[model samples]
Target: MAAKPGQCTERPKSVPGRTAVLPWRLAPGIALFAAVALSMIFAGSMLGLAISRPWLGLGLSPFAPVAKLQDEGALWLTAVEGPAARAGIPPEPARILSIAPLGPGAAGGAVLLTGADIMEEPDVLPSHAGMAAYFARQNQLAGLMAEPVELHIAALEEAGSDTPPPTAVYRITPERRRPLTSLPAAFWMQIGVGLSGFWIGVWIWTLRRGDWAARFLAVAGTGLMASAFPAAVYSTRELALPDPLFWALSSLNATGSLTFGVGMIGLFLIYPRRLVRNQFLFVPALVLGLWRLADMLEWIDGPALGRHLAILTAMGAIIVLVGLQFRATKGDPRDRAALTWLGLAVIIGAGAFVTTVILPVALGVSAVVSQGQAFLFFLLIYGGMALGVARYRLFQLDEWAFRILFYVTGVLLLLVLDAILIVTVIDERAPAFALSLLVVALLWLPLRDMLGRLVLRRREPQRGALFRQVMDVALTPPGHDQRAIWAALLEGLFQPLTLSPLENATQSSITDEGAGLVVGGVGGLPAYRLDFADQGRKLFAPADVALADELRAMLTNALESRAAYEKGVAEERLRIARDIHDNIGVQLMGALHSLEPRRKDQLIRETLTDLRDIVNNASNPELSFDEMLADLRAQISEHVFAAGMRMEWVVEGGDSVILPLANAHTLRSVVREAVQNALKHADAGLVRIVIRQGDDAIFARVEDDGKGFDISADYRGNGLENMRARIIALGGDLSMISGAGGTRIEARFPFGAERRRR
Candidate 1:
């Protein structure tokens, strides 16, 4: 038997929530990803240190002809205690006619080199003379890493005035190894990009776990490490690596770059909005894989143009995919916002990558900077993606796109100007960059401000007009329409694309990641939902919610005050009606009993009946529609009988309906006046009365067969005007038509017309 749970020495082991992020039931763990990332970084660092350990003892660097105008014929050679330096090689600068290998394993067909060889361009057409010369020198010096190098030294001579310069051959034997601690600054930079990108990508991926975009970003990071580690060994070579090893490293770098582009393209295609199906996401990788194989096999113009062209193609695809996503993300402000930032990072990083690797090959020129340094830009891409997960959460914001776009435009413009000045005029980078900043500040900054004001900061509506509109809704009379005025007021302020009721909202707030706003209810009014601020051009922000809250509060207070005033007026009216009923009604009733003449008695009876109607209508809060119609039919029948005329009363369709006492009273007065006027003036033999309820309104018509009066003439004297006023006051329409036969009065009173207006 098991012991009581608390008393047991052994307890159940706790297991945290484990969700599979991979198909093989792999769960996300930070420590697991960290271990894998660190392992990769360590392996890459060791490989880079090992491959670059062998270095020629001489510390040679590229010599600029422009810097040393007097000695433009030779490259610089730093003084060092090495085989070539002790063999009487010039320590300052030396012009070499040709360098021949005493053995095999060096690059460039094992051919003779010359001073002119250092100055020659590689392509069929030359572009950027300085870059071309630097490339030639780098290629020539690479052979010096081999053993037993024979240098044909040229005597110091100037061009155009020199006879044949004396040349002598001197062979340098053996190669001294460089310590791992002496690795160049560029190697560390390359490794830093690799490790940072991988770890950041993994960290972000761990958060989202199963998100496709995050996974693709992690792939891009892996590509960064793969590309950078190999290029670090090759690009930073102090001397030549073996031909096979060099080729192998170059192929790996090409593979990694293309893979990076493929990953970026896939990320854009899936993130923010899925532009394509999951199965087709790997199409780009498949195509690039085939291209890489062809390049390695020397099938597509060999290494000269194959990898560069493939890289260019991948970039082109990414650009196209970005455009597609932009169109696909319409009507979704959140997706568009995320896309804007993500697109910026990918395009800028890819641009820098291609500029260093492929742009040099294009324009038929050599790279202006070391290609390994370009890996740093990929760090920016990784960092941005991590921030998307860690800080901004990618789709959580909608109004930041325009701001970032504006800043990026200004930054890229400054960079372009600075680069131009550096390449074309100023040799000092700091002064050139400072001058570029000053120029931009003077010229483009004003334009940027003007454009930003036009696009981002719209002028607000006048405060006076806004307040007046609010007052209009608050001051609306009890029987008149105010809902239309309220709706218009809100429309004039925010101009949201959609306005709907918000269920159970208690406070005004930005919602749906700034895609919408919810305003709380006030003064018995339900909450409202407003989406896509500025008519779908922008998203609702916190400032808009604050404004909504203030307006709602103001309107709520105004409505409450209005209610209080109406309450006071209603109470006073009730008191006056009571006094009139108690005091005036008894005296009038006594006067009617004392009358003797028939006409005077009839007048007194009518006055008493009118007083009774006024009291009853005022005291009752509501009246039934069917009851009112029945009472009217009976009264009309009796009046027609007393007048000795034929009566036709038709009623249809109001079995169970009710009306407010005020509306019922006004409608009753209008119909009675119309009947009375027809009997007294129309001189008709027969009268027809129709009272019917239509789908959305109540219709009443009274017609007489008598001498018709011309409607063109002024005809409002016979109680027509009073009837019209009564109908109009109740928010209904009144009409009259007089013909050769008789006159017809038709009135239309919509159901709940006054209710809606209120």
Candidate 2:
């Protein structure tokens, strides 16, 4: 048996439950927590260290060789000025007395002390006598000095001498100068280690944050810090250097500073939001680093190159920091905090460099401090960034933190192993080779994991959600009330992901009496179908196949249901008609025929009235096809009687027909319209209604024999046009032909076709 429309043959209710949301899946929150925890730990440790050793708090050491020379010279000049004033002798102008370090077994330059002027040559004292007197005074001063010093003083009477005379000169040979100590070497090593650690930390942090640009900036920052040592050495040798190396180093220093500033600005701009793409900033920074390396090897002019190294290094650091800051701050509030930290780092570093490193070298400042300030500042900035990445998962921080942590830990472990190798390996080359192998082995897993996480993190959330939603909808079984569920799923997936308007191409529907619905398309593509069932618990089939089948099933069910309801109503109406016609009509006829002459007329009239009442009562309900055909036959018979014309009536093929009350009423209206047109316009004596059912169509044909008119010219204003429209609205087609002999109207309805098309 064919199942009725909307009736599921078997209702399968049992289905598995939906998957629950998991706690570990929230990457953002996890990342945030990790970053915050790490930052706090580092910060606390540094803060505690600072409190314990306030002098070691954070700054570069102010005890470079040049700085020491300037300090001692300035001090000696001050002391000499006081003595000269006390003795009532005019003071000699201040000058530097420097002893250049010599080669093996050779005496370096003497303490060449030259000044602007000495006591004005007395008129009584000649040039030779003045020189002798100055030497005697120097010898007396040397005898009074704590350390043994050689005196070599000369006085020139000529004011315009090309070379100024030595005034109160003292020569300090290699024996007199203090021997170089290991303390400076140890201090510098500590500074290097601290700075190197800070840079390494920053690189790890940037990598973890998925900030390639930041990683580059961190490298540049490290380069800048490292340049400081070379810069100091070069500056100390500035006076002995040739021209080319001096200019080259100076230019390099300028370039490095510019590069470092640019890099810092870039880091700042890209740190939080990570959007800057400019590569020009890195070019100068790389060039400076390479040039410094070349200069260190003496591949370039050594002395001159050494002269400008300090400025170049400082310039590089500044450029990188500035570039980072500029890039990082370009983002919104979410990134503002991180960018601010980077900015603070640049400011603190530059300030410390200027005060401790630059000012002391340029001026004769006597203040002395440790060289850990820049390192500490760097640690804070990069550490904070790493913490931000771990805690907030800034730029996929959660994914980044694990990978970064792994890489950092692995690298540290490798470094430790290398240190072990150095201690244990006998061969000089073995340790380095072993260290390289250990690094590669240690980094492999972490690098792989980092790459995997990066790829995963890049997938868009909305697209993933949409895919899940579609799969959920498709897999659910038939007979499930999935309309509301589908709607909710669609809304959830689409609302957040919708960057543009969606084009709805296919019509959607829900079964009126069951638990299933049809969805029209997939991923905004061409029309396909999806049907969810079993309370959206399981899938019946693939979306396209199921949806198409479900739609066909729905159409068939609706048509059959309508057909059954109409038939039942028609049968009920037919029964009532039969009862009135057979029983009541016979009785009325019998009474009228058997009545006496005088009372026969009255009896006949009363019987006729009774018959009419019975017929009226039977026809009072809405007309069915059978009832309509019966009435039309009677009406045409009456018309034939009244008009005194030969009238033929025929009804064909309406056997088990049924229609809804609304549609039955519409049909009646169509019939009435056709009959009225025949009566009013056709002026016909004979009327015919031919209802025939075909495989694809149901048709009603009404024809008449009367005065006919042109269908094209007169039908537009006639009642026939109205009848055609009425029939057409009911998913039927209507046609009218009127000519000299007759008028004919025909209408055909294709059952269920119109609804299916929609």
Candidate 3:
């Protein structure tokens, strides 16, 4: 735990709860699907009136009065003094009790229309602005755009106070509404918002159903889809639809908007931290839903109730989001990432709605964006919301979002300006196109680059520097400590609060087992364990694991390279040693024989000894202590005889002890040097060498009787200090005592010292 400022003893609490993100489940998916199905059913049944005949319409002027079926099975005039009235239909609204065919000669038969029957009509794609673009295209292709169709209709009016009710029948001839006349906007809009909202909701529920934010988004999406039904059922309306259908659609829209608001508010309350208990969060939504219901039933006047609730709820949500942003700024990077995307989307999406719809309506002016277009923009909000929930490319989205937003805004603005120029100045399509091209080339592209740079600076100014560090790591030459390099790379990338080896880590990437990341060793050992306990107070995400895997691969390559280089170096050293021994050593031996008989042979012997040492050192031969002792005794005997002196060599105990190649070599050198000094420099007639083993130590002594010297005065000149230093370096000891009687040199080494060093 990091020590907190001003407090030496207090420890920070662990993150309140472990985020147990689970695999997507089937149950939540099914429930989400059910919710959509139920919503569609309810919206389809409650929001529209449908009248079925061979065909139904009247060819009348724009001023024509239109009639519609009411909820109570009544024929009501939605418009007066128009087509219906001109066609000799009565102006008074009447209830239709029943209808019957006049005779076989009648063109068609009709009966009472009920709310249930209307509700039972199949749900159809939304139609608005023009004839549904697809249907219009189909009609135009089929040459039926202006074709006339005959529609049969009848009404059974309720009887007056004293008169019997009468039934009337009429034949109405009207041209089919051009199927494809309307733009395709409504079709695509409905599909876009409805399908995207539904599936995004399902996706959230399936992946993060227990998350408060996910649940809120799920509800919001479902509500948005349900509310969209009203706009979906009509296509390019030149006049009002029937009474029941119009009012029902209006009521449904209000209800759906309210529900959406509720979802928004719920989302605000739960995200980041729970402001209140989740148990009571739904109470506000329920109460508001009832208010919508009461208004729909005419129990209260709620003409602006839905709109007001929507505005209020939105304000509350925005306020909560601001608080979240403040908190997230100092919180987890993941939290900051999520809020960044969400904030960008809210700015763009809400700006569209507010500028084009809300502001215009508030100012009592026509909206720049049509109602159809306004609804389409809601898709943007849904898209952003989904991305935020999924945490897609969270750490990397900052610059990208800025670039995309800038580009989109720039394009839209340029297009608008180009249109203005074309209409007000040029009045030519060709000039408009050219101007658009020019704006993109001369202004937008360069501006995009500039904005990108600015955003990049704001986001990660050290990104380039970090990349350079990574490159340096990758390019580190072979023979360097690869493990140290790996450690440095990790520190740069993750800046882990604490790094430790994870126990029993088996996989290169692991989460649930409590290890943040585990990179396997070359031989399947748990080589590296990464902990993110203080990684911006966030858990390691899947993306972090992926990055670690990539780096680990790089580190593995570096290790392999270093190993290969060391092998090459060793091979080269052996080759050099072999060449020098085979050529120079033979020449030196020949010179020894050619020298004069009286000349000192010690020089040649030393030269040969040096060559042998080089060869031995390069080859790194391993031998047991007994074998090394035998070799040393043989060398000592040759040197003693050459110096005209005798050597009494003895070895006792430690027969089975094996020495490392280095220790064996050192022992050989030390024994050879001592015996030579006794025979040559000390001028001793006979030297006695003894080797003995104790319980935990090996002891060797070389004693000689010669011209005795003062121990301290001649030690440095005789290389006694050098020999002592070498023994001390091996964690052993060397002692020498020389006086008028003799000189004694002793060396003692802890048993298995070389093995312990390894």
TM-score of 3: 0.46
Please tell me which model should have the higher lDDT, number 1 or number 2.
Answer: 1
Candidate 3 whole-model C-alpha lDDT, 0 to 1 = 0.53
**RMSD (Å) of each candidate, 1 decimal:** 18.6, 26.5, 24.8
Measured by TM-score, the strongest candidate is 1
Number of the top-ranking candidate, with lDDT as the measure: 1
Candidate 2 wrong stretches, greater than 4 Å: 1-109, 113-198, 201-212, 229-255, 271-333, 355-376, 399-758
- In model 1, residue pairs whose N, Cα or C atoms come closer than 3 Å (at least 3 residues apart or on different chains), thus clashing, are 481-757
* TM-score for each candidate, following the candidate numbering: 0.47, 0.29, 0.46
lDDT tens readout by residue for model 2, 641-739: 354444444455535454544455455566667766676666676776666655556677777888888877876786766776766776778777777
Question: For each candidate, what is the lDDT?
Answer: 0.65, 0.44, 0.53
Worst 10 residues of 2 by lDDT: 53-62
The Cα RMSD of model 1 versus the native structure comes to 18.6
**Candidate scoring better on lDDT of 2 and 3:** 3
Local lDDT at 441 for model 2 = 82
